[model samples]
Target: MLTITDLSLQRGGVWLLQAVSLTVQPGQRVAIVGANGAGKSSLFQLLLGQLTPEQGSVALPGGCRIAHMAQEVKASDRSARDFVLDGDLDLRRMEAELADAEARGDDHAQARIHGELDIHEAWSASRRAETLLRGLGFSDYDIGRPVSAFSGGWRIRLNLAQALMRPSDLLLLDEPTNHLDLDACLWLENWLRRYPGTLLFISHDRDFMDRGATHLVHFDQQKLELYTGNYTAFEGQRSERLAQQQAGFERQQARIAEIQRFIDRFKAKATKARQAQSRVKALERMERIAPAHIDSPFSFEFPLSEKVSNPLLSIRNGQAGHGTAPILTGINLTLLPGSRIGLLGPNGAGKSTLMDGLRGEKTLLAGDRTCGEHLAIGYFAQHQLESLDLDASPFLHLQRLSPKASEQSIRNFLGGFDFHGDEALSAIRSFSGGEKARVALAIIAWQRPNLLLLDEPTNHLDLEMRQALTMALQNFEGAIVVVSHDRHLLRNTVDEFWLVNDGRVQEYEGDLEDYERWLADRRKDDTEAPRNNQVTSNGVPAEASAGEGVGESADDRKARKRAEAALRQKLSPYRKRQTGLEKEMDGLQQTLQTLEADLANPALYDADGQARLKELLGKQAEAKSRMEDIEAEWLEVSETVESLEAELAG
Candidate 1:
């Protein structure tokens, strides 16, 4: 379905791909894997025609349609469902033509357009769009919300939904699960498993690729090679290939040594001289196989804390949430020196709230929360990426942390995290998401904290970095609590599972496969009892319809109607505030992003840009402060709405 021949590409004067060629057959799911900046995304761009190769040809089967998700989505005022439905360009175009035909009284053209619309399934577009949204963890109410009303991560979800809604012969997704919770990721995996099209995606999640991809493409050494299985299988093949290459290299070196020995012992001899000269020429012409390069770019471990406490942190009868409302209650948890717990729950199920409660970012609404004197915290959250100083380099960030530490020691330490040489001293404003995440982890590792709270830490990490992080976590001598969609990380690093759901936290006794079964059973129960307090996280109904399905006896149905009406009446104000706050936050964040982008430019440091720079910096600070306030208000309103809704259901 897709073919590339003799592909050569360059970016910013650097060669990315040279003489690369690959073919993807129809109905095959291919995963492109590589280290950061190894041109995985560049390959996608080339396939999408956004980038023109220096010398190559890319061909797709004639008339084949393509669908892809953009890495960055701009803020927009369009409703989420409508934005997704717009992916079906044919449906929208046919509707427009049909309207024109009707206005001109052209019955024949109108009929033709109607047939096209039917073929496009235009009538069901909205339903399909909404289903995609719901499966991606958007609440039913969120379907009609404006695109600008969601955060950046949620906007990324909208982009994924949009791509999934489009009918195509091929689909390309880049890090599709980066922002998704595990529940949403699972739904996506199931959806892709049933997708009747060629699939190619860039994913850093090992377990996701293992479950979804049927083929692997590794971008390495300025070449692209195809393998015949999932990520794990690819690893096996790669390991064997490297072993063979190493064996060849060793054998060639031994042969060369033999040739050299013959040359040294038999040189200047009338008979042996001819043979020695031939051996030298043969050695010169022989192609050398490069040794297998298996070292990870990252190698760092969390330093042990200065002091240890048996139970570093404790919370009893804790009601945790923002403001006066509680999102999670009856929370009794204790963190010990060796605790390694992974938080598992559906989206909006208080996993992040638990992290915040543990981090003391959110105060307890009721009950007691305590900490040991040596309970140092190293919390890593997505928001911290934005909180980083764009003007400061990694070296400066660390230097600010520990002014007493020698620069050489710090640089050596940073080198382990792959921020070497100028990269260590360079501004981080233009760093990719993975680079920024590494910097955050580097700071946390340097802190030597006894307790760690990490939320979605692997969102933008690559596979190698994630493995390094897993190893680091395994060797750490601290209590760790993490909320991540990367199942591989959770399985390899964490020792216990804490399931947070239905406003409570409990220990789950099974592995990830068991959690999947639990989710499936919970979904079945939610379908049977749609309005119960035990809500299915993604709002999935029994059917794939956009709206709720009716399922109750006449008396029970009437009671539900009455209760829904009352709940709606009470929630009306909070919902309104919720929308308003979301819009306000989006606008503020957009403004902040613009300012940050402007501040990131090197020219902003010059004399001419100083005036403008100063103005933007001031505005940036104001926008950020307002963003925080709006977020706090939004959290309060959302918590109130959720609590009231749960109460109504109960």
Candidate 2:
């Protein structure tokens, strides 16, 4: 357990965190959220005792240990295994002392050393160290590799493992998932979901917070508000709170108006002078909150480019590879201008290979590929960011990347991405993964390419940046082919998906969630299908089939067939309700858009129109409430159906 009482911190004469007080109890997951630099990291540092507050105190329970994983980690000239093993420095040293004493034939010294060694050899300590190392994605080979040889991302992971290895009662993690790939992030999510220790993590990963967090601690407007739920639940609660706050303020304003009217009518007559004075005093004493400013979603409209011919990029049975092995084969695909296509599959499902082919980097095995005339393309790779020189500062990196841009323009561009002041001068090597990703994005934006190929582009971007990028891409007139695992981002940004599987690509209409649901259904067939089908159980079949009845049994007329049919019938309504709910949500969104446009019109300033707008806002709230209820019902129904179906199939 840890408590902060009257905590305040200042940097560069500006109060970053002031008079913040909160208690973090054992077995609680607290998410520290704020606008980019609302002192989330500084608060974590204060709790970790790395930084002392300018005022107040941090009180920890007696004998409570704390561990912290900061956003950035420096790679040193040491093997990754050695770096993690170094977490037990005291134990290792003690063991060495014991070995030395035993070889010296000094019985008295050996007796003392044995007691020290016994304390260091605790089973809990070893188990925790092993768990931390493995949870952070260090295999046997990785454990032995020198830290110097590892990429900056791997070094960050190693540092995280080392910090977590400490026997800490409370863990403070700052943006822990920024450097992690999909596989490692999933492992970490599962691990943290069941972790017993108190966790106070600062992250921009909405999905991770939705799964791992039990409480949300929002630091905003020089105050902290605690919400008792995960991110989605917290979002709903925050919306309600803001609405109530606004309503209360409006009521107060109306009361003040009434007081003003009464004072104006009576005060001049001297019959209600005292009342007028009292009303004035009351107005002075009212501790009103400044009207809350809700951030509207980022608005973006890309400058439209001239229309180009169809088949922006054509791969006619293209064959692409590296060295003697082929990464992709028989890849016949065509990209069209203005298409927002999401490339889906696992990490090495040949998405990048196809991108390389489109970029015309490798030899096509036996087919022709063509690029449209006047096609200006931009390509982004997850590893491509590493090519930036670490020694260069952020400003220098940008200046070097685009020499034509003036210093003021470069600074302005960096500021748009939330990099300003000293941050712009910070060494590229010192930047967090999120910062680097922003730089990569800035580079892409500067080029103003007509076609964009992005691989895992959302990996290290913060929520706000992701939303901004989505807005930018949504408005861009050029074509975009993106490979990403972020379902939320992909769903919001992409118009369609190019499902890459089994050396071929299939087009699917709709958002990334559609692709995910389709994949989930396909995965169910692995165990249900014949052994010769070569389908894997994890949902990624060796070869994809185009149909809704992927894993459905072809023959089922047996003793349990009656039961199966009954289950299906029971599930049919829920499935139908789910479908109807999805359709209703779509229609509601369109209506909301129309109402929002009307409200934004300057002519709607009349009192009657304002009231009408307010009523529409209330309807929007009601629609949101209904949507949540429907989604919850659908989830419960689906879960029940799946459980029964799994049992019957077994």
Candidate 3:
């Protein structure tokens, strides 16, 4: 068991935790959740003995082995596999002793060491390390690469693998999914589920928290509150408690108001003077309950484009790659107004390539690319943050984009993203990763583009900011194509998913759950394939024979092309209708969400607010009914489209 008692911690003269207490039992997976700078990482540092608390005690089991995933890894020339294997300190120690014994020509010591190695199963250490690497999205070829060969993101993944390589009684992971793609995130989730140790992780990924967390440690108001379930359960329970607290606060206020009124009316009268004094004393002695405050600091929306064209962008027979080598080929895609697409694939399967192709970044090695006259693209990627002017303030960043815009307007917009006062005018060089990401997003939103291509936009964002982004995306009228590992964002924001796999891009017919199962099947197939058959980034065998139509006759090829065009013509109306229905449903859902939020206001239950409440309730019901009708139509249209596509394939 891990225990913390009276943990009062302060940093830079600011209290992060005050009298925080938590007890975690063995093998419990606890997810620590809070806003950035809420001391979630500080608590981890305390547990790791890197920081001393101002006043507190932390207890761990005697001789407990702790494994922590480092936030950064120093560049090294060491091979990736060797670096991971080094995580197992005991295994390395045993091997070192055996080597020393062998060098000393001590036969008895060598034999004893060999027996210990056998008992420890040290022979399989390399294989186990390789397994960890593979599960974390490293290819067989990458296993032998030097640690310095990988980029910053991939290096973080290696660190995660190293952490997993170590045997531990307690494991600490901070934002483990931040650098991982969806497939690797799923793999890590599965690994954590089977880990026979106490797990304490800090993550903003909701789906990951739901899947792996058996409990939650919430940091709020300088206190750590433990909940006995997953993140979803914590949300539900917290909502209930907040509602109750709000009600109690309202009641207490009403009672206090009544007492104040009594004191005002009877304080001059001798008969009631004693009673008024007693009542004043009672009011002062009454413990006040703080009103529930759950508002997110970040609140912003993508500005609507003044002009948008149908089929804002299109690529025909496109081959996206670097220089002359294609990473993704045979790509045909169209982005229309109101289009919302989420790209799904394994790491390095060219999701970013496709995004770049759409962004007109010279990634198209072959084929025709066209953009509408009114098409305005707002492209956001991780590298964009690096391109930001580090010395400029957020205010300066926006002002540079629009020289004519007034300072007040820019400040107002920045305020929506929680950048206010001095922070807005401060140089971005001192900002954290999350703050920089917010700036990048703010820049994109300031442009008011008709189309958005966001790749991993939520990387360093906290949960509240992520929720804000999701809401903004939902309300956005422009087209969006995003590549993100955040399933919650993908599910709530995108109407369709595109699978960028096997060197081709196609619409994914199922939801995120089905995509997960597809990945599992692909991983299983990869494992079962022959060792000598190297797999490409798209999971295709590198030595595969030939293209499907390699030997086709000219006439047959022409006929096939004609048939494909005919099928597309036939499917066009259904596809358009499906898209239209999805847009309608999205609008109605937004309306319903607005109504729900209004209804959730505490004032809505008051006597004076009954009329407004009734109106909101009616609006909610009507929107929900419209949503149901649209959903039914959407299902029918989707099924018809699927049937037509299946018929064409057959």
Candidate 4:
């Protein structure tokens, strides 16, 4: 449980929060949302005790353990798994005590420490850390790698894994999905749903918030408003509220004008002077209602290219990779004037490789890539942000791109990205990540390219800018291929999906939901077997054999069948447990749905219904906690079943 009373915070003499108060009950997942520099992260800092509020108080239950994902990780030679395991301070402390006891030859203390470790289930700590890392897109090989070996983005993922590893009753995550791919994002959603604690996170990902958040804490006008439902529900409620506010504002304005007109018309007459003075006091006492304001600062569309080609780009029999060895082979792709494709695959797959090959950055080893005579490409990627000139303004950046373009036209274009006047001309060295990303996008948009290749273009963008980009992409009259974790953007912008996996590129004949299921099945299969290329003992390709018993003796085949049957018998209990957990989860989900519907009634939020509201909230939290337990049990049992199946097959 967490509570803030009359919280007021200021930074650089600017108020970020003014008289904001919120109470978050235990087992509630809250999504903190606002524009950039709107105090979302500042609130997190206040909770973490990194910053003190100028006034008011923040309270947490006594001795409650808190865990938060760090935005940065210091470079070190410690193994990644070790770094994650270190998050469990209790386990680490116990280990240290055990070592000391052993050095002193105190058998009694050593035995006591061993018992404590067993009670804490500390034996499985390493495996748990590994699971967290794998869910965040790290390969098994990466577990033993040093922290210093990972890039900045991967290090951020390491921080997330470390945060997840800690045992706590409160978890805080800020932009946890920023560095993750689609697979990792889905995995994290499931993980967070099963976190039986108070969850407070800030994310610009709409889909993520909808799936994970049970409550939304909105920051607007230096005030915090708590909504009892997910982002979609919050949107509906906010729309109604804004509409009512606007209407009230209009009515109030009309009444004030009427009062003022009467006062002006009668102020000179001696007989009506007293009445006019009374009207003036009434006008001054009237509380002015502020009009509702909701408008995005960004508005821009991709300009059409001057020249057009039927087939803008084509690649035939392409083999793309880092060096001599190819990661993706037999890739035949063609892009036309209106082609729009989204790439889908697991992490470390060939999606980026394919993008590089299509963009002509990676030379095809065994095939030819052809381009139209008038081909023009606009490519956007995270690394491109680093390529920007930090010393130059956004206007200057565009001007350098088109040396002959007029300054007025460039400024007008920059205005669409919310870079106005002095800000447009200021050097970008001190700009935030989102600002730099916008400048990169502005340059790409100004090129008027016929083809666009974007890879994770919305990494640092806020929700408003992401919506703007989605709108722009919808109206673009050019071929586009994008690789992004933002499902909303992919679903809205791309017309087709291409799957790049296992050294092959092919069209995926399914929607995003179907692709999600496909990924789940693939992960299940991967857990049953190694991902390395399958080969026989003699180094022959496994798939090259046509018959089932081509190289097996009758005794060996019978033995294998017997072993499989025994393994199935051994796995029956785990399968049963898994089934029971799933059933319990389904029942809890139904209960939660009913409770949410009941809570949606506007009457429950009124002044006379406080008791019922609190009661329903408590029930909701209880049901969610139960669901979390069931899901965790199900995951453990499912993993056991898969492992047994793998052993039987072997």
Candidate 5:
């Protein structure tokens, strides 16, 4: 359990979190939710003890251990297993001590060493580390890979795996799902559901929070507000609360008007002087509740310069892969104007290759790919940072992309995506992951292309930014070919899907979920359909997940079933735990509601009430601790069930 009292944090002389006091109870999953730059990350830093609050104290329960994971991870030369293996610092130290004792021929020391090994093994720490790594999308083969060889995104995944492996009583994570693909995110959700520790994390991914976090904490304007429920539930409750607050404000205004009337009527009368004076005092002392204002900054729209009646881009009898390694073959499809197409597939399924091919970057052998006239393309690659000149400022990137554009135009474009002032002038090499993403988007926006090819565009964007981007894209009158695993973004923005498997593209009629089912069905199909010559407007194969001569068998079928079932079972408790945590979080929020109400009373700011407020902070900490305990217990139960199931399967 951890407690914070009168915490205040400042960055560059501006208060980020002010007078913040809260508690995190064992076994509770708390989600920090807010718009970008609203102190959510700052709070996580405070909790991690990475940055000390300028004006308060954080107290952890005696003997409690803590682990923290940031939004971005940096790595040198190390494999995934090496990264996770480092998490067991205590184990390594203990082993070293035992080795030294054995070399000295101490029989008692050897016995003690054996006992220690037994205790460490009882925790199944090494096994758990392996499982966590696999869950985060690293294969067994990838376990020994040097960290220096991994792409930045994959390195982040490795960091996540390592963080998860760390043994601690309380775990704090900042945007843990930023780089995870669909499958990995699901696996993480399942793992966290059963983790036997207090959980607190900052994430912009609604699906991630919905799947795991029970309580939502909203940080804004240097203050923290608690909401009891998952993100969706919190939104509902917050809306209702806002409505009530508005109603209360209206009633108070009406009462004040009546009081003013009474004052006007009785001001000249000695008998009514007391009444008039009291009314005046009441008006002066009343603290009106302010309504919440929601604003979106993403508002750029594509200039509908031209329209194509047939497909904007078409492919016929297309085959794509490196050398003879065909990722997808016989691909045929047409991306019509105004169609929002989502590209869905597993990792290493050639989704990226297809996108690059569409952009005319990759050579497509055995396929006729054609682009419509007047097609101006804007691309957002997953490795966008790699594309940027590290030495240039974000403004410079925009300028390079649009040389004739005015300085004001560039700054305005940057500001729209939450980059402004000094941030725009910051070198691309020095920017944060999110900042770089914003800059990349700003560059794309300046070009104002009609055909948008987005590869995981939502990466590094906060929730508000994601929503804003979604809204902006919804209005664009152009073709959108997006490759992403974010279900929510796919559901909201995509009208159709192109599923790639085994060096082929399968066109689907509906959304990503439907495409996923179609892929699943293809896996279940008994008859291995021969490669048909018939191709659609776009040159893509109609089959699913077929690589050239990668034969399937009954064992593969059994394995697929097992994997799918395990995925569902792994996620089940986390889903249930998320629900339970939301309820508990809501209970704790009631205390905050009371505190806010008391604060609204002008009298509560007086000296006596200030002391009482500090006392109330203690109660909040207690509530936080209790919530954490529940989260830890939920994690234990979830993990226990998973371990038992794994044992039975073994």
Candidate 6:
């Protein structure tokens, strides 16, 4: 069991949590719910002994292994599978011992180690890690891809997979679904349900919390309160408590008002002066109950489109993809003024591809797409967050959309989205993912677009913001096409779902419940027919009769060798150029590091040291310049190499 006893945490001379005490039994799923900066993360740190609590103690069973998802992922060249496999420390240790035993020619020790590994079931660690990767929406090919090859969101998923690979007694997950697509979220829900360890996680997705957690711990008024049930039940309980508190506040206000009236009426009279003073004292001594603050910080709505065309956009027999590949073939879709559709599919099944096609950002491989002349688009994607001007304020971004709008009006509108005062005027370079997401959405809404193409718009948004968005969308008159993993948002906003599967898109007749059932049936079919022609998790043929650790036939081997030789012959120059660029960058980086070390010395500012400092700075600039050039060359070469490699592999 995990126990926190009268724990108090203070940061920056303020109490984030006070007199907080909670206990979580083993094998229990406890969700920590709170507003941002309410010390939920601080509590996790306290449990991990990363921070010393100002008061009380945290206790976990001795010898317990704890695992947590990392918020930041460093770029690396290591394969994704290897990174995930590295999480199993015990397996690695055993393997190391086995190698040592072999080197020492100790057959008995080697045999014993092998037996231990067998007992621990370490032999299938690679396969198990791969299984986890597949469940998390990684293709078999992606598992072998280098970490540097993935985007920030995908890298976060890699970190999650690594954490999940660990053998643990306690698991701590913080916003695990922030980067996940709908399919990945569904798979993760199933995975966490099967997790045997005690789980403590922080999430803003209410549905995910209700499904994943058995207990809810809410942070309010510098205090932690444990509730008996999931998030929904906690909300009900909290609402009732707030109602009672509001009643007490009203009574206190009324009593204070009565005392004030009496004091005002009697304080001027000679005989009642002393009595009035007593009444004043009583009013001052009265303990007050503060009213409940139930209103959400975020409250904004999309303005109705200027011209609501009968058909905002329409596509017929569309084939959408890049190059010669058709991700969504023979797709026919139409969006009218009130059209509201949610996209559902596994990752890489081309929901984003479909969105791009609809946005007119990508050229359709076949068929025609037509839109009304008055159609206006507001498109949102994770990548668009990157394209935001780091130096521009949210106010400026909105102004760019509607230059004629008054600054005060724009500021007032942005305040509803919680970008207040200096935050609204400051550059967004340092903003968090959620903040940037808000800015992007705000820009979209400012346009008053007739058609919205939202691809995973809820990625970094919190619960209140999500609720606000749901409400806004409910009232929106524009044609909406949104793809999100937040089921609550989907249930509340979208009226229909389009299932993208096997290079085709079609309307799914049923709701989310039926979709879940469909997934279950498909999974069952996958298990029963592991080698079907249909796409499975692996997307690879199941070679059942080929025996354990099957090898290719002689003819297959010869053909593979020929193909590899031909590809190498074709790609030799690009590979060599990449190698050359890497060497140059390595040397330049070393020189830069040496120069930076010299610049770090405090004495470099002295008059005598100024000359050497100037020289070193000059050299540093030169090295940096050279390094930039090398990096550009490397990027070109690397891209070329990757293109060739992909073609070869395909």
Assess every candidate by TM-score: 0.74, 0.60, 0.74, 0.74, 0.68, 0.73
Please give the lDDT score for candidate 2.
0.65
Q: Candidate 2 or 4, higher lDDT?
A: 4
Q: How many clashing residue pairs appear in each of the predictions shown?
A: 0, 8, 0, 0, 40, 0
TM-score of 4: 0.74
The ten-residue window of minimal lDDT in model 1 covers 525-534
| Per-residue lDDT over 1-650 for candidate 2, one digit per residue giving the tens place of the 0 to 100 score | 77888878876687887787888778899887777667888787777677877888999877566777745556676656456656655556765775687688776675555444333333234345545655555654455456777777677787787766554567788888776654456556766775557899987777778878999898877677888988666666665556566664674465446445533543464643443454454344322311222342223333444556576888777677675467677777777766677787544457777777788876344568787886777888778778977888778877887788799988877777767888888888977766788777777776667788887787767666765675566556678888765554554445556767676767754443354455446432112111112233553333432322445664543434455445544554454465556556555665666767666766558775787777877887887787787778768876875676576445
Order of models, best TM-score first? 4, 3, 1, 6, 5, 2
lDDT of 6 at 507: 86
Model 1: residues >4 Å from true position, as ranges?
Answer: 105-108, 244-293, 524-650
lDDT of 5 by residue, 392-430 (tens): 888888787678989998888777777678878887787
Score candidate 1 by lDDT.
0.79
Off by over 4 Å in 3: 244-293, 525-650
After superposition, candidate 2 runs with Cα above 4 Å error: 70-78, 88-94, 97-101, 104-141, 241-293, 296-298, 344-353, 362-367, 381-443, 446-448, 476-478, 495-650
lDDT of 4 by residue, 289-351 (tens): 112224568878889799988899999988999867798889898999878889999998888
| lDDT at residue 187 of model 1 (Cα atoms) | 81
Per-residue lDDT of model 6, residues 1-650, tens digit only: 98889888998888998887888888789988887778888878877878998889888887778888888889999888888988778788987997798799886676566555544555456667777788778886687678999988899999998888887878899999999987778778888887878889999898788899899898888998998888776766665666565654574465456545544653565643444454455446332211222446887889976677778889998999986668889989899987778998877888888898898766477888998879989999999999999999999998887899998999999998999999999999999889999999999888888888888888878777886787677667778899988887776556568999999899887777778777767652122111111122453222322322357788886786567556655565575577567657756766777788779887999999999898999999999998888898889888887887787556
Candidate 3 all-Cα RMSD: 25.6
* lDDT (C-alpha, whole model) for all candidates: 0.79, 0.65, 0.81, 0.81, 0.67, 0.78
* Model 2 TM-score relative to the real fold: 0.60
Best of the two (2, 6) by TM-score: 6
**Candidate 4: segments with Cα more than 4 A from true spot:** 244-293, 524-650
